[model samples]
Every structure is written in structure tokens, then in C-alpha cells.
Target: MTLRILILLGALSAFGPLAIDLYLPAFPALAQAFGTDIEHVQLTLAAYFVGLAIGQLIYGPLIDRFGRRGPLLIGVVLFSLSSLACALVPDLDWMVAARFIQALGGCVGMVAARTVVRDLCDPTTTAKVFSQLVLVMGVAPILAPVLGGVLLAAFGWPSMFIVLALFGSVCGLAVWRWLPETYPADMPRRPLGGALANYGRLLRDSSFVGNALAGGFAMGGMFAYIAGSPFVYIELYEVSTQHYAWLFGLNAAGFILLAQVNAALMRLRGPQFWLMRWVWVHFASGMALLAVALAQPAALWPLLLPLFCSIASLGCIMPNATACALARHGANAGSASALLGSLQFSIAAVTSAMVGALHDGSSVPLAGVIAVCALLALALTVWTASRD
Candidate 1:
């Protein structure tokens, strides 16, 4: 892929992360403003994940039928409008609703970006391309929370939504002006019924299913971190909001850096080779995290270290596993990408909700859930490795 194309695709894929991470520092403020608890505000994040999970399924077939650009344009427009709605919401309920709508719009970019990669690149190159895209995508998480902290301290939480709206608008214009429709209109389009069948076929494919599950469970661990970190760092550790933002950014930086390392290692190793190694790393780090949390350590650094290591492992797993899954389905790249994304986000939504539901003023719930996700991912990896 050209640098220009990589940048554009990366930006498109980064929308979801930007939306999630940029407002994280404002969670306490949002709860206070709405006269609700932090957990209620957390439902907005869960709602966004739910929207992403379902919206991709809808867009997958539409993109295949209509081609990529049209659905992408519409999704960005919807995302922009919903972001505005979020900024203007009258209450927490409206905020949650608006976030769901925002996710519906934002997810089109994700599905379309992956489909376009499949359309343009061969399988070997796809893994490299995805790693490069992850590098580009990594910028949002690295900067978002810090920017959010500054904005939250100076302007307030609603300003974050305004920034998100502006981001969507800019990305929409970029897609319109630059992103070519990779899916040709003349391509054979699956009928709606056939599309559902396509999903069934994918599910039954042991390789695809295993890779998807492995990636999904790893992503679930990340979502658990996202959902529970604010409480763990700020409420439990008694960190300031500014410090919390930096801490969040620190973990994101580790993730980005390791992704670059994965890209480098991919030159010498197969994607699956690296994926297996990282899955083990993730499992080990997660176990260590659980050990620390269970012991009730007096200092926060013990927990933070393993937590950072676990999240960083995702930098290796996500791009490689996604490339592996999509590599198996060239003829139906859109559907394949959709199923992969939907499964990943669906897992994320469940993990996030579980974290919230299991919140008990302790770090054990988050650590326990993260450990389980990592273990499940490792099992999936081992099961699939033999097949490969």
C-alpha cells in the first residue's frame, strides 16, 4: 500500500479508539453532571461496543452489495451527527443513546478499511499492512486521553464530543476526497439471505473460527482494561485525573511500541508464529496480574506493570490474527472482515459489561476477567496451531 492509502485507512480505523479513549478521563465528571454513578456512565461505553458489534454485520453485506465508499460515507455522516447529539444530550440516557448511534456510524470505517486491505493486498502483505495501520491507529490512544485530560480540566466534558464531531467530519471529507472504492460495483454481490449463509460458512470453518476466537478473546482482555482502569487507577489508587490520563497514555504507548516491534519481527517470522508467542505472553502477564491483584498489594506499581504488559501483547495479536482470519476468505472479504470485527467487538462488549457488573470496589474482578480472557485466547491459539 502507498503511504497515502495507509494513512487514510489507519485514520478510518482509528475512529473507534479515538471515540473511546478521548472521553475516558471525563468519566467521573460525566457521572457528576448527570447525577448518576460511574457505572451508569460506563454503560455508554458498553453501548458503543454493542453498536459496533451489530453495525458491522449490517454494513458488511451493504458494502459487498453496494461497494465500500457509499456505505463508508453514510456511516461517517451518521457518526458525525451522533457525536453532535452526544455533546448536546440532556441527560445520561440520551448520552448513552447518542453513543450507540455514534458507534453505528464509526464502525463502517473499520469494516470498510479491512475489506479494502483484503481487496488491495495479497495475504503476506496484508499482515504487514495491518501492522503499519496499527502504528497509524495507535496514535489516537496515545494522545486521546492526554488531550481529554487537558480538555476536561479546561473546557469540560462536552467539549470532547465536539472534538469527536469535528474529527468525524474531517475524516468524512478525507474519505470522500481520497479513498477509492476498492470493491468494484461489477463484483458479484451476495443476496441478503446468502450473506447470512456466508456467515454460517465462516463460523464452520475451523481455521477462521479459531483465529477469530483467539483474537476476540485477546480483544476482550483489552476491553476489560478499558472498562475497569478508571476505577482501579483513580478510585482505588487515589490518583489524580491528570495522573490517570498520563498513566492511561503510558499503557497505550507501550501498546504502540510493541506493535512496531511486532511489525519488525514479522519480517523474520510468520504472523502465526508471532501470534503464538504473544498469546503465551498475554497469558503469562495476565496470570501475573491476577496474582498481584489477589495478593492485595500495597503499592499500585505491581499491578500496573503486569497490566501494561498484558495490554501491550494485544499489539501483536490483533493485527496478526485479523490478517490470518481475513487471509482465508478472499472471495468474501467484506463478510469475513465483518464477522471478524463483529465477533471481536461482541466479545469486547460482553467483557466490558461484565467488568462493570462485577465491580466490587476491588481490582480482583478486573484482574480475574483479564486472566480468563487471556487463558481462553491461549487455548484457542493452541487449538488452531495444530490445524495450521
Candidate 2:
């Protein structure tokens, strides 16, 4: 791949994580800014997941019709504008609303970028490429929060949104200037009914649904950690918000480095082997976490260590699961990619919300949710493998 193309795809992947994570240090501040509770501020994060889920489904068909350029350009522009709106909002409600809009604007890039990768390579290669893709994707989550912490200390929550706005704008311009349109002229623009019908069919396909759920549940478990960790780390463990940023960034660094390892392993084992092995490891992680949660630590450090291991394993899960699901159906890749993304985000929102709702200012709640999700994903993966 051209360095330029890789960068463009990587940036496109980065926008979602950057949009969500960059504002994390601002979470507590936003609660204070609007005279709201921390739980209310958290709902804003959940709202973004809802928007991302809904937007992914819409953009899937739209990209198939319009090709990747127009929809992607539009999404990035809107994402930038929404970031500014979020920065300027006077109340919690307004911030929540703006975040939803920002998520909508950011959704197209993810779907299109994955579709574009699949277009350029076949399923197995798609898996290999995504190992690299995710390392690029990992940069945002790894840095955004640390950057958010710095921005928060220097400029406050409002300024964080401004940084987000600036980030979005820079990405938008880079996309417009540097990225080539990959969808071919010969690609058919399906009618709305045809697109819907295609989605309906894929949803019914047991194998597709199986892989999709295997991936979605795997991500939902991670998203549960994402949604609940700020509370658990900062509130329960009583870590400083800035320190939490550093800690969050550290785990992402683990993910980034491990993704590089997964990429290298793909050369030897292939996507299928690596993914199967990863799922088994995750299943074991779930059991380990369950045991840890039951043990109930007085200090957070021990639990935190293994938790990082599980989260890091997603380095193996996300990219491989995605590439496997997008393997066939090149004719309807946009819709397939879209639905896969939508289900992942949608499942994540629901799972995260459950964790948020159940938050008890203790590690048990977070650990319980994570373990359950991991267990379910493990069951599904095993079932899928046995069927074949």
C-alpha cells in the first residue's frame, strides 16, 4: 500500500476513537460545567454510541450509491462542525446533542475505510492489513486522552472540544487532498429496496450473524470497559483524572504494540488461526476476571494488571473479527461492512449502558459485565468453529 493511502485509511480509522476518547478527561469537568451529575455526563458518551450505530447503518447504503468520496467528505465536515458546537455548548443537554451529531458525522469514515480496504484486498489479506489498520487506529485512543489531560489542565473542557474540532478539520482536509477514490465506476448503485433486502439477507445468514456476533460481543466487552473505566478508575480507585488519562493511554500502548505483534503472527498463523487462538485466550481472560472480581481487592493494582491483559487481547479480536465478516459479498461490501459496524456499535451501546446503569463505585460491577460479555463471545465463537 502507498504510504499516503495507509495514512489516509489510518486517519479515517482514528477519527472514531479520537472523537470518543479525547474528551474523557473532560468528563468530570463537563458534569461540573453544566451543574449536572457525573452519571448525566456519562449519558453523553452513551448517546454518541447510539448515533454511531444509527449512522453506520445509513452510510453503508449511501456509500454504495454515491461511492466513498462524497459521503466521507460530508461526514468529516459535519464531524468538525459538531466538535465546534460541542465546544460552544452552554449546557449538558446541548453537549449531549452535539456529541450525537458529531458521532453521526464520524460514522461514514469507519464504514467506508473498512469497505475500501476490503475492496483493495481479499478476506485473508483484509485481516492482515487490518492488523496494521488497527495499530494505526490504536494511536487515537492511546494519545487522545493523554492529550485531553494536557488540554484539560491548560484550557479546560471547552478547549478540549476546540482541539477535537481542530483535529476533525485537519483530518477532513487531509482526506480531501490526499485520499484517492477507490470504488470503481462499474459498481452498481443499488436501489434502496435492494440495499435493504441485502441487509435483511445477511442478517438471516447464520454464518455471517455468527461471525458478526462473535466480533460484536468481543467489542461490546471492551466498550463496557471504555464506558465504565473512568468511573471505576477515577471514582472507585480514587485515581486522579490526569493519572487515569495516563493509565488509559498505557493500556492503549499495550494494544498498539500487541497489534504489531498480531500483524507479524498473521504471517505465520494466518487470520483464522490467530483469531481462534485469541478468542480462546479471551474466554480464559473472562474466567480469570470472574475469579478476580469474586476475590474483591482492597487495592486496585492487582485486578488492574490482568484487566489490562484482557483489554489488550482485543488487539487480536477487533481487526481479525472484522476482516473475517467482510470476507465475501464484494458486490454488497458497503452494506455488509455497514451492518457489521452497526451491530458492533449497537451491541456496545447496550452493553456499556448496562454497565453504566449498574455502576456501584466498585470493580465488581465492571468486572461482572466484562466477564459475561467475554463468556458469551466465547460460546458463540466455539459454536461457529464447531459447525465448520
Candidate 3:
């Protein structure tokens, strides 16, 4: 991929993290504005996740049938319009509805970005490209919260949505001007039934299923950390919100740094080799985290160290797993990308829920959930290796 294409894909892939992180600092203000509690406000986030999962399935076949650019442009329009609605919403229910719409539209970029990469690159290059994309996308988590807080203080929480609207609009423009249709025009279009059949076939492929699920479980562990970290840091560890933001960013930084390193090093060793290496690192770190939680250490560094490692391991895991999974499905790249993305979020939804449900005012729930996800991921990786 050219630098231009890489940048565009990176921007596209960054949508989810940006959307999720940018509004986080405004949660308290949102609760107050809607005359509701934090739990009610959280429904909007849940609604977004639901939309992302379902929307990918909806877009997969559409993009495959009609091609990537048209469906993608429509999705961008939907996202922009819904973001505007979110900014204008008068009630919490309206906000929730709008957020769901936003995610439904925004997730097109996620599906299409991966599809585009598969359309353009061979498997090895695909992994390297994805790693580079991570470097671009990874900036969102580090910057969005601080940026959102600044926007909230200066212009109010609604300003954040307005910014998102602008961001979507710019993305749409970029797609229109520069992004060529990567899906081969001469390729026969699939009917909806055909698309569904493709999904079924994908599931039946042991290598595809194994790599996809392994990636999903690894991603689940990351989301588990994101969900549980606030309480674990602020309440249990007695870290202030200000300090907690820094801590979160530190972990994000680790991820970004390792992703760049992986991009460079994978060329020498291959993505699969490093992928399995990091899988072990991921599982070990999770076990270390569990041990730290169980020990109830007086200092927070022990827990933080393993937690950072667990998150950082994804720097290698995701790109490799994705490259491997979609490698054989270039004919149905859109559908393949959609299923890969949807499965990831599905696993993430489960693991995040586990953290919450298992919460006992300690780090154990968070650590245990991460460990379980790691174990599942490790098993899946082994299964994938055996199948190969």
C-alpha cells in the first residue's frame, strides 16, 4: 500500500477507538444533562457495541454485492448524520438511539479497511500493513480523552459530538476523493444467500475459524482491561482520575511502541512466529496478573506490569491472526472481514461483561477475566497451529 492508502486505512480503522474514547470524559456531564445516573448513561456505550456487531453483518454482504466504496460512503453519511443527532438529542433515550446509529454506520470503515488491505496485499504484507495501521489508530486512545476533556470544558459535552461529526465528514470526503474501489469490478456479484453461504464456509474452515477465534479471545482480554481498569485504578488502588488517565495512556503507549517494533521485526521472523511468541507472553502475563490479584499486593506496580504486558501482546497477535484468517478468503474479503470483526466484538462483549458481573470490589474479577480470555486464546492458537 502507498503511504496515502495506509493513512486512509489507518484513519478508517481508528473510528471505533476514537468514538469510544472521545466521549468518555463527558460521561458525568452527560448523566447530569439527562437527569440520569451513570448506569443509564452506560446504555449508550452498550448500544454502540450492539450496533457495531450487527452492522458489520449487515454491511458484509452489501459491500460484497455492490462493491466497497458505495456502501462505505453510505455508512459514512449515516455516521455523520447520527453524530449530529447525538449532539442535538434532548433526552438520554434519544442519545442512546443516536449512538447506536452512529456505530452502525461507523463500523463500515472497520470492515472496509480490512477488506481493502486484503484486496490489495498478500498475506505477509497484510500483517505488516495492519501493524502500521495500528500505529496510526493507536494514537486515538492516548489523545482522545484529553482532547474530549478540553472540548467539554471549553464548549460542553455536545461539542465532542460535533467534532465527531466533522471527523466523519472529513473521512467521507477522503474516501470519495482518494479511495479507489479495490473489489474487482469483473468479479461476479454474490446474492444475499451466497454471502450467507460464504460465512458458513468460513466457519467450517478450521484454519480460518481458529485464527479468527484466537484473535477474538485476545481482543476480549484487551476490552476486559478497558472495562475494569477505571474501578481497579481509582477505587481499589486509590489513584486519582488524573493519574489514572496517565496510567491508561502508559499502557496504550506500550501497545503503540510494540506494534511499531512488531512491524519491523516481523519482516525477519514472520508474523506467525512472532504471533505465537506473543501468545505465550500474553498468557503468561495474564497468569502473572492473576497471581498479583490473588496475592493482594500492597503496591500497584505488580498488577500494572502484567496488565501492560497483556495489552501490549496484542501489538503482535491481532495483525498476524487477521492476516492469517483473511489470507484464503480474498474472493469474499468483505464478508470475511465482517465476520472477523463481528466475532472480535462478540468475544469482547462477553469478556467485558464477565469483568463487571464478577466484580467483588477487587482486582480479581478483572485479572481472572483477563486470564480466562488468555487461556482460551492460547488454546485456540495451539489448535490453529495443529491444523496448519
Question: Which candidate has the highest lDDT of all?
Answer: 1
Writing each residue's lDDT as its tens digit, candidate 3 over 11-114 gives 88888888887877676688789998544566677677778888898999998988999999999999989988999999999998999899999999999999
Number of clashing residue pairs, candidate 1:
0
Q: After best superposition, candidate 3 residue 200: deviation in angstroms?
A: 0.7
Please give the lDDT score for candidate 2. Answer: 0.83
User: What's the best-to-worst order under TM-score?
Assistant: 1, 2, 3
The worst-scoring run of ten residues by lDDT in candidate 3 lies at 37-46
Error of 1 at 349 (Å): 0.6
Instruction: Write down the RMSD of candidate 2 (Cα, Å).
Output: 1.4
CA shift of 141, model 3, Å: 1.1
Clashing pairs in 1: none
Q: Positional deviation of 245 in candidate 1, in angstroms?
A: 1.3
Q: Candidate 1 residues 241-357, lDDT tens each?
A: 888888888888888888888888878978889899999999999999999999988779999899999999898898889888888798788889998999999999999999999
Better of 1 and 2 by TM-score: 1
List residue ranges in candidate 1 displaced over 4 A.
184-186
lDDT of 2 by residue, 219-290 (tens): 888888888888778887888977898889888887777777887887787665677888878878867876
Candidate topping TM-score = 1
* lDDT for predicted candidate 3 compared with the true structure: 0.86
- Segments of candidate 3 deviating more than 4 angstroms: 32-40, 297-299
